[model samples]
Target chain A: MTEAVDDATLVQMFETMALVAATDDALRAAISAGSATLAYYSPRGQEAVAAGFAAALRPDDYLVTTYRGLHDQIAKGVPLRPLLAEMLGKAEGTGRGKGGPMHVSWPDVGLMLTTGVVGSGLPIAAGLAWAAARQGEGRVTVASFGDGATNIGAFHEAANLAAVWGLPVIFLCQNNGYGEHTAFADHLRVDHVAQRAAAYGMPGVTVDGNDPVAVHDAVSVAVARARAGEGPTLVEAVTYRLFGHVFGDRMTYVDPKELEAAWKREPVTRFRQTLVEWGLLSEADAAAIEERSATTAAATLAEVLELPEPGADEVLTDVVAPAGADATKRTARAATKVVVPDGSVEVSVRSAITLALDEALESDGRVVLLGEDISDSGVFGVTKGLAAKHGADRVRDTPISEQAIVGAAVGAALGGLRPVAEVMFMDFLGLCLDQLANHAAKLRYMSGGLTPVPMVLRTAVGGGLQVGAQHSQMLEAWLTHVPGLKVVVPSTPSDARGLMAACIADEDPCVFIEQVLLLSRKGVIDSTPIELGVADIKRPGADVTVVTYGRQVHQALAVADALTSKGVEVEVLDLRSLVPLDEAAVLESVGRTRRAVILHEAVVTGGFGAELAAGISEALFGRLVAPVLRVGALPAPLPYARGLERLALPGPERLLEALEWVMAYEG
Target chain B: MLLRLPKIGMEMTEAVLAGWLVDDGATVVKGQALYEMETDKVTNEIESPAAGRLRRIAQEGMTYQVGDPLAEIDED
Candidate 1:
């Protein structure tokens, strides 16, 4: 009515706000009556923020919101029946009863994500904006969070990255007076959330969240700037939560006077009275609107409460792409077509990797590369010349924001780009493990087959480089332990090239770890396409089996050759992929040899070798000639001195000792 | 003598003839940059293997498979 929109749009915003209020009241009442048993975050006073921003956006624009997003979800056009059904854990819900309240995602209504982690959705929203920018669709993405989220590192990383890339995204902060139990002043030092946007070189605006028209105008201006390719904007809408943070909270920490004042200025009441004063609606008409919203909310909840619960078998479904298909038992398949070259070329592992990335980028339009200094080919020169070859957009160089980089890659994958993001060192995964382990690894399973995050996080693991404790750890065991994430380690140049292509084409998220010690190792790379979860028998022998991967594979091969001179033939099995641990191949080789030794570069304590040894013993219990032994580095942080570094890792002598012990087993 | 498209990468099967550096019927020596072929987003300049009168058989902007004949050269 003021200036943002015509009378019809204002009425539409009021209608959305009314529906949100009616649903909130009905849900709270149901919880009080014991009809619903779930933890709920009440958005009683934030209806105007949701309604206003949603009114400013097109139905097709992407929206990433937080756990307190029932109002946002309804305003963004999520159907009342499914939204209510989800609240009751029904099978017909948006997430098929798997995501519950915190992890809900219904891409059909442009509600791309509802994250449970505080401030985690910001980086993912930036990634979605990147994809939209690439697709040349003027679709702007909105990331909705509370005032407290602005204090998190992800908020800064995402805002800066979005501004640097000129991405189309709006950071919508609903400053509802408190961050959970703590007041805003206690959590954040900034007076206004929007004021921090200046640090990221983006426009900052604070609006009256209680006035739907003001919010609409602010969001409209931000959306316009985004569509015009002016990059991201920070919009902080000031409001208050009328109730306690959660449904069951007694509000002992809140001041009685402040609570009462907030209730008097509740958004639904204020906006309704404003509409009446502006002559946009009569008192009877306003009453009818409220009546219609309440009736719809009640009817939907009643029907949803009767719906049956999700089947118990849903626990195993949608854990990875090709929903419900077991990755371990999946047939070895090539997702990318391979064209065998006429001849093999001798190249280093690094060069082979560059070739694989180049091939994927040239052949597949969806393939993209992003990492720190990747445009300069990274620290190892693996991605050298790629930025110039594929253009900066495809071979992107990101700031040292690991969380934002990986989160954005996950978001880009959801938006249909086969993004291959690189973390400079595998040890740096700690900085971004939440995005990798929580969001990227669980999005497919949490979305209940509604979303798939098909991206590759390539990292380097070095043990003998003497980079000390932080940068020289082989953390593959940590990654392999996580379900829904495929782990790939290439021992040869051919495997590196082939597996890189396969991982990019893979439908599930993958962690590709490159061993720094093998980057310059020369080998003949051929055009043979390799399928994931398949193991290669480098040397076939019967006396014993030496199972290894990465740089240790070469050491095992050398020991096998040396043992051949002593009349003991050792079989070397290289596991190119770790997660889908080629159980059949491991069993076949160990069963033949009747003796096995697992070798790896990681520490002996709790290394991936432990998993392999246990698995081998359990399967080949009585038939084995000797007990399986695991050879690995000493259980200590790798030292900076070369001698200490070499001492900690498995050397040729260690491999020979393990081989001879298995060969000389008397048990 | 015949010049054929060579495999660039282990995965490359076909490449686009981006452009010809030397015109048709131009005499070129061995190791001289002759034409541009693009594969896997990389553009490589193919050199003449032998000096001869070149006859451009493959047109510019056409894609050819590896080992496909691109041009014929009458040896000097």
Candidate 2:
């Protein structure tokens, strides 16, 4: 039994629920008729949850929901037209036809993400709530899930974390009598799913989910408690899903008698009855509300149907944020140049990095640097002179929390700052990948080409220095797999300076990798400028092309020198940029030589060398005298022993071996 | 000839001017560091790329921005 809400508000809630239910039905019909023939999970009976939660939340409060989230999305302020357009998979949809039924996200109106996975939203919601609480933004997160999610690991983990952190979150569970075809009694011992909340040290309440007033009152209390920073509360609304799990479910497990009884307890009917008993609405007025809802839904569907289909070019758009032809055009225009200023001496890689940072800060006011001890000595003194020159305003030190550092950098980049974030070592990149992959890489594309997040990640890489297993892994191949990111690995000190300068200037996100072994290596550098996406040919020969990057470029150059002495002509190509790879250059060089060897510092299996070999093979299939060969570190954890370590890496001897093999082979 | 010390005194008679931040005959004002010089530790500013007529009495890598008279600037 639950206390009753006011009559007038209860009627309004019921009207909203009915409108949402009608919208869900209309959307399903529209989706089926659309070109994609998308199937929708209509929230017909669970409309009370939406009506209840939406009524309690302010516009600023964020709401995260699962796939059966049409009602919740609507309640959170997504208009009927956009919702309809989304279901129709139209360009005007919330996700610009990118995300279909399963992925509905509206950040503008506070719908964080409505995922297809049953329990994934729970953890994401908890994260949002934690961010809100930490920032003291007075925002609360409402995570709506179905009874099936209660059994998920994400649900438990999220709930436990939220409880421990005392995050401002509300876990709303719509316990419809059955989860898909399985009945509640068949799954768990507890009569009410809300009883499980006590195990996490939080208050749980079970309400008659069919009654809009009961649902509203329960949600209002939970929302208030969350807003007050009293931590999370669980609310289980016991209701019956009138329709099958999805549009085509037969609902064979539902008993005929039980189905009829459940229909009588429909939230719409119960709320209307309560409203009539309290004399808040006449029969005619209630009938008018239903009529208006139907009219609105009809109008929405008509508008969606009249919309044009996405053009062919629209297919590639919104795949990354700031989606436009300009992205590709800008990427095309960035060419790597070897800039060598007269009388300007060539410096060590470490000194060049420090000089570049100093020059960049002096040149651009928007540039900022953050990492552990970056303001102090920058771990390797690469940023040592920066703090003294720029003061601590532009140079910042962060706690050891990789997630926070990366997330903050993403935020700052979004706020229009060129953030150069250092991950100390390339091996530690694993710790902050969520921000890199999910937020930084996906935000632009996910937002339908609206947001452009520009950031530069500076990391030290390679394994030759005896730093051992933890500190010495090169994982550039791992990052190159992602689409929206550009990676630059510079072999020379001048390349480090010039590439770093270009990365700061580029509009797209880039990863600037500096090899640890080359930091102290000195070389003569010309004062010409360098750009991204273009490879430099260090040595010109005609027999075989040795394509390499980072520290391996030196090795390949050495092998080329050795091969030339042995009466073999080998050309050395330095792939300065990984993404938007110099495919044309590679093909041209390999075509001339009619043979190729791809060399890198990463492990052999699934390395960037494989991609290079495949590209070369595809373009120069007939032109090649031999198949492109790959030379990379052996696929094993780097050992501590110097001999073993030397054996694992692809050095000059290894490159010579690979070159000799490729030269002997006849395709 | 006019020369001002770049920083506080040293027993050294001359300093090697690394490079000029501004070109010769460039308008320099009083108190501006026109040229850069190197000590054993780091580089320091020579004098003014000033409002007066500029002159270079010191050659790069051989002259000091401090101890030696860098140049005589004619004030207009």
Candidate 3:
């Protein structure tokens, strides 16, 4: 009941699959030999889908995949050396040793992004396709996921969006009969995952996943249709997972009889038999293919083993850009302060921010602001005048989609624009974390110094405005935890202006957190230059050092002044930046004062203050006269009531009390 | 030379000069606040451009066209 094709090309496809299987074996061997700590997701029996899709694709078409991407990547022309280097975490890896097995990417060859998360790559692929379509470049996006991802929200959302927009995207589902250890039948109700595509108003097709020719034909048609602006297609290729889910997954549920049938109908062997019968190639040719593949794999493994480790500076350079490029130089020069008249006048922080943006926009053509409700004076009037002055193109008003706002900014940055994306409130950062942490932070390093994303993320933090829990939150610690990101918290209007200017000028991605409570608080703002990693000493003392930042800086300064009157001589240090943190200043100040008190408005549990206290204890143990005391908000949700909120957050009085306790305590 | 406020709105044709900080012929630097004006929602200071002598054309409590010369600066 099936049509049989000729053997020659089928034999070649079989040979390629064999080679891929051998590479997977080599990866497992490399891991067992203790030469590498690799997480190998073997596509032992399910090789037809990869061979089919890869054969259909041109070198220019993009492929974004998930954790089980080894076969697809290799078949799509990724050299074994770099992939092995990545598995080994060597500098020569596809991701420069930063992304191990799961996060492999080859941007040059058009494999834009890859991930370990099951369905997250789908939306990203849709975005890339959208960009390519807007450029009219005729590049198609191929995103592959497993049967498990069929139920994920991102997969459906991406499918609906792609179909509705008629984007040039191909959604490939390699239904390997199992998601991890669970059988597909137990989880999915439908006989075919492709049948679900009708809901998105797109054509869906089911192919014989074990047959390379069938897969090739289906994918070629989908690719062509996508290129012709026909829309996206979901191709469900029925296959089986031959190996355990991971390196050591136990095969407890697999039936022996079913396994035997799967082995007998193995795609590589069946295709090879079909090829030999049709006289497409001789037996010797197939043997030669196997021999050549082994030799190539061995050579690649040797080359990767010889690659050197990444340097120390490599960890810090790629968050935005390194210091030599034209963009970097321009940013550095712009960061330097120009001579201007100064006076302490009454201006709200919101107004200062608007003025800074206006000045930056007028001064530089590359600077643009994008966000939701930004055109309508923003939520708190921070970007109130921008849209009217710069027009909608520069100050874009986006839909209520945080992910799209951040992702588009990343793409725009790659296209040579400095975008400052505002996420209204800090609490909403959770909605767009993938764009921030994964794409923007990792793109430069993953591309191996090829691309840099210079973007600024401006958001308001703290809880004193009675905007409720959803609006007011001090979530700077979450952003600071990620490497390659620069975190800044400015407490004064002058620092807000200067630091924002510096952030706009820097080549790295920066998260500028402005405390909402301090928007109305007034202070003397000296027009001094503020660098990214430098801490400012607000007051000099001897008994104890009170280290803090953001809204807590004012409280710490007041506490220091109050303690000074009592002859305690407490020093106050305001940490302007969180990442590339001024650890030296903290250590030096704590070492000199012999006692330290860390304060913050964020919750006490796992707050940045805990890290500071631990660092001081580790570095200045012998010099310290007492244990480092941490003063932070109570370990509970911030209350809405003014009095209750005051009780929850650390105030000047609390800092003074903590300083007194640290000053008198004998460890 | 004609002095005008940068394009701040699509429909705004004129703005009222609420107050002036410096007297006529006073030198001003770029980005220095020369006068204050009241918009629909808030009061904002209009900064000066170029270092020169400030010549006030519109007095306080008066309005002028968007691009009309509110003041003239004679470069040294």
Candidate 4:
């Protein structure tokens, strides 16, 4: 026995490894027997790596793993009953059958995240470690991913950030000679996954994954260093996958000779023989442990197979946390609004947003700000003087790494912080869409309400500005389309402060897009925050209902003003938030006006105006005077040329024309 | 010398004249920040291209296409 591990610890590792092997055997058997249908990634060969590392970590420490994470979950103390039931898609499963075998999380036992995307766990692990570092708990996070994951951009970004911040995270790469069907040699140019750590200025170690003692020793050292705040480490465990990538995969690409050779050194058998040779466990005792594990796994599988599946109601239960969840935690701070006798104070949109951020940061200690150049007041000055007031740790200036910026914020949110992340430009969301859309937007639903990502992604959209094609885009429709995300756009400075406050306090991920043109626009704002999914009637009239948001609200109001002098009154409804759209307000307005016009800055084709028009047509049908009109940019990218730009966008003249057309309409 | 609007960023094709720091017919030194233009929500100070008397062509609060003359500098 290795001096680093005692007799009991070594035997405990064997016991955990045996449970993983037995669970794999039972699950594959059930799948073959047509009793439990699942997409299983068997961890039959790489059991020792999970067991060894899990043994080294405290129960309270965090674990982030990939889709092929059954072994890791088992070793980290996820109960066999619930784990098996989850794989079987039972109601009592970890994710309430929402996340199948590919995704599972049990925070009670510290198995925080099991990501379906490759290399996604690394950045989240870094975030968890960031929270751990702040908590001063000396707890470390272990992220387990395959050798192929090391090649992804998220791996590089997370590794560099973890090193730079001295985050207590362990990157455990199980180099099982293959990344799915592709051989490791075919995928990576480097000799070892650990070699990449040198570029990030962290310790990198390659160990024999087959030997539990070796993995345990390496992980223990890393844990000790991390506990001492020394920084993160990358440990590459060399092993082999005995089975195919998935249960039904033929694996025809694998050489028979190599497969035969890998089976001979299979971890479970090799470790059993080693225990027998050391005299720590006799042949009979080892057989008993294996038998016990197999029997327990079989019995648990039988019990889970009979459990009921998640009900249909579970589909909508966990999409978002209940409203006022933010109020429970937020302490009172200085009111952001400057209320005079008129119950409002005139301020620019930029100043209003700054006030909202300042209030959020002041009221809630968990609130943090992360973005590019934000520490030095950001490009637009909305985050001006925040870093100096909140400290560098709370308001951080990140490298030009969008994926890491958003991914780390998600992880921080999952790790119990209300992160307000900025992507600088709306066009740059493509760089971090996976983190924002897949991870942040779906975590609560995937976890079946077990975890809520109370975070906000703040980005600036510049449609009016002739910043060419790429930089000028108001992609609010894209965000509102996402199920678990709340999309908010504020027209006036008052709505900006109110909506920004609501976003910070929301229990779901929110996309707050600031129309850059309105940054300098002035309006009166008060402390009363606007509720999400509520519409504000900026100008109430009876001729026609002009439904709009963001920059178009100003155009709609201008048209309303010009028509008012012409003896035609127009009612303008500003949809402050879009996801949980104020359909009642829309219906009431369109019903009274008997006509509607939807205005926005996005292209007319597939713009959010289409949805509004369709909804108004369906609900207020036969009561309107004419077909719903959508006034938006032309079906073309925002042109750089001055004349074309004006011609393309829905200008005040377009709104005026639409208003005149609706007024003259007759059925 | 015509003081056409200089592209501030790779994507910038137009900018709003926040205001001209130097008045019309004012003698401005070369390399001096002569006017402030708003682009992509950021206010940038445009420098005088030559030491000359500035004759303003663009009005405040108006957006000009890139390369459109904002002012003419009469070299002295």
For residue A635, give model 3's deviation from the true position in Å.
Answer: 1.4
What does DockQ give for each predicted structure? 0.00, 0.00, 0.00, 0.00
Top candidate on TM-score is 4
TM-score quality measure for candidate 3 = 0.73
Cα lDDT tens digits for candidate 2, A1-667: 3245665656768778778877865554332222124556778888887888777777778777877888888878888777767766788877676666666777777776666667666765765675565456688888899998888766776677677657688899988877767888887888888999988899999998776667788888887788888999999988778876865354667888898888887777677666777788888888888888878986777778688766678777754434233333233322223233344575788877776677677766667887788989677888996877787747877656565456556545654567788889988888777667666666556545544457788888759877787778888887888877888998888788778877776666788888889899876555466768789998999899988898888888777887877889989999999975889899899999999999999898999999999999888898888878888989888878999999888777888888889888855
Locate the minimum summed-lDDT window of 10 residues in model 2 chain A: A329-338
True contacts kept of 1: 0.00
Residues B14-76, candidate 4, lDDT per residue (tens digit)? 789899898889998865778888877467665664578989998999998776777877987
Model 3: fraction of the reference interface contacts it also forms:
0.00
Model 2, B1-76: lDDT tens digits are 2544333222333456788766777777754657666666445554442248777676777754333466656767
What CAPRI-style quality would you assign to candidate 1? incorrect
After superposing candidate 4 on the true structure, give the runs of residues whose Cα lies further than 4 Å from its correct spot. Answer: A1-3, A330-345, B1-76
lDDT of 1 by residue, A1-667 (tens): 1245889988888999999998987776554333565678889899999999998998889999998999999999999888877766889888888888787788998888899898999999999998888898899999999998988889999998999999999999999999888999898888899999999999999999988889989999999999899999999999998766876455777999998998888888788899899999999999999999989987788788789999998888887766334343223433354333335657889988888888878777788999999999898999988889789999998989999999999889888798999999999999888888888888887778777888999999877888888899999888888888999999998999888887887888999999999999978877677778899999999889889998899999888888888999999999999977899999999999999999999898998999999999899999999999999989988888999988988999988998898888898
| Candidate 1 chain A lDDT trough over 10 residues, lowest sum | A326-335
lDDT of each: 0.86, 0.74, 0.76, 0.86
Query: TM-score, chain A, per candidate?
Result: 0.96, 0.72, 0.80, 0.97
lDDT of 4 by residue, A1-667 (tens): 1247888988999999999999988876554333555778898899999889988989999999998899999999999988888777899999998877877999998888899899888888988888888878999999999998998999999999889889899999998888778999899999999999999999999999988889999999899889999999999999888877876455688999999999999999999999999998999999999999989998899899899999999988888886666675443555444222244567899988998898888777788998889988888899998888889899987878888888888888888888999989999998888888888888888888877788899999877788888888888777777889889999988899888888887888999989899999998777675788999999999889999998789888888998888999999999999977999999999999998999999988888999999999888788989889999999888999989989998899888888889889886
True lDDT of residue A555, candidate 4:
83
Report residue A250 deviation for candidate 2 (angstroms): 1.9
Native contacts retained per candidate? 0.00, 0.00, 0.00, 0.00
